[model samples]
Target: MSAQEEIDLEFLEVEDLLLRTVPGLAEQWRGATPDEVEQLERIAGRPLPRFYRWFLSRMGQSMGPLAYPSQDFSARRVLDCYARKIVAPNPRFLLIGYESDEMMPLHAFYDLDAPARGDATVTARYARGGDDPIDRFETFHEMLSWSSLFRFQFEQMSQKCEGTLYREDADLLSLLAPVLSSLGFTQPLTTGRYCGLYERADAVMICGGTPRENLENVRTFLLGGSNAGVLRRILGEVAKESSLEVEVNTWTPALR
Candidate 1:
């Protein structure tokens, strides 16, 4: 299929997923016009990657909780801001998106001297620490796909369910849902003001509070306890099901 056609199909699939999973958020999607996209390219002085350009032409700007900057913050504005604040000099990098919290920017590097390709090196740079990107993607599409999956999973965890387990901060839940889902647990159910439950192996795992608090609770339960062996086996099953390298020893902070 042509590049545009492929992007259209992929964009449609993502949009459909978002609509079904988070209809309230999907309503904020807006598509840009061909003229607007051309203007952006002219302002940036570089051709955007094919998939990203197609997204601008089709999906425009997303204003959801998981979105980057809206259309109101033009690409030129974002790039200019990046140029001003960037600590590490990388002239080839162009701003594409930001984390949900807007503390980090997602950038794409263009190599004009190299042969043309649809893919680009995508990275996310933190604001406070070193300018180096903490995360990298081989292609922009991969980044978008990951974001879509995360959004879907986050929404799933936010839903109310029976026998609910694990209720804590939303941000913590966002990071934990995928891991728990991979472990054969049902989506978390709200059992109290700040508590929830997950069922697996015919047992209920209670979880709640901040990410740190919940992680501690989990660690205590799965270590030096009678059920530790069973929980360890279940976690192994989860590792096999997920691509994410599940490391319980460390907490990876995610932007909400």
Candidate 2:
């Protein structure tokens, strides 16, 4: 696999914080079995990058700056339970699950077409909403770059304070939101009932925030695409003296 195909094993660092975020995960997270790790590597079709391998090995420990969430491999295990359908996004793919009192949708792995071609786009939709990274350049590398940025964001957020959905801090939101906005929502026309944002799996969805926890939908309709030029403009507006409060916006959350 190319360097970009490698999951940033460094995301393993925040497993403790991850466990803290989702307390129920504590007991289930035994380290990945040798077979499991090998299977994952095989599925990804590339050598598992040291970062994620380290993550699987030290599934319960905390490390690194970002501090990704802990996984007893619950999501992985959940997917494993559905082995026939829950295929890897890549040969070296890893699965992450988001569950709740209400049913959370199954995670999606692949986004665009063949990873080798570089032209990629990932999408995930729930009863509520989903994310779809707007594909600009058709190149696989460009798609991969977009994918990497998104995965980094998801893994990074997973490590933040427990029970917090998406970074709650305004500064971080301001920084990431505009760029994410460019990623595109799956349906351009929202019936005014959904929120949307990017995902680690390279898809976009309306499920940006957890219900009642951190449920502010970053308005992607305001941003254009993933290009730096577009990002600069959005970021510039973010820094403006005026707050971006708009009048009477209305949208519905997708029904469970």
After best superposition, candidate 1 residue 130: deviation in angstroms? 8.8
lDDT at residue 146 of model 2 (Cα atoms): 33
Clash pairs for candidate 1? 164-189, 164-197, 165-189, 165-196, 165-197, 166-196, 166-197, 167-195, 167-196
Q: Per-residue lDDT for 62-110 in model 1, tens only?
A: 4355464432233444445455765232445555553444432434443
lDDT of each: 0.44, 0.35
Residue 23, model 2: Cα distance from true site in angstroms = 3.4
The TM-score of candidate 1 is: 0.46
Each model's Cα RMSD: 12.2, 14.2
Q: What does candidate 2's lDDT look like per residue over 148-226, in tens digits?
A: 3334443333211111112233433344445445543233211111233333233322222221223353332222223
Off by over 4 Å in 2: 1-9, 24-28, 49-55, 58-106, 110-172, 175-242, 246-256
TM-score of 2: 0.33
Find the 10 residues in a row with the least total lDDT in model 2.
158-167
Candidates in order, TM-scores: namely: 0.46, 0.33
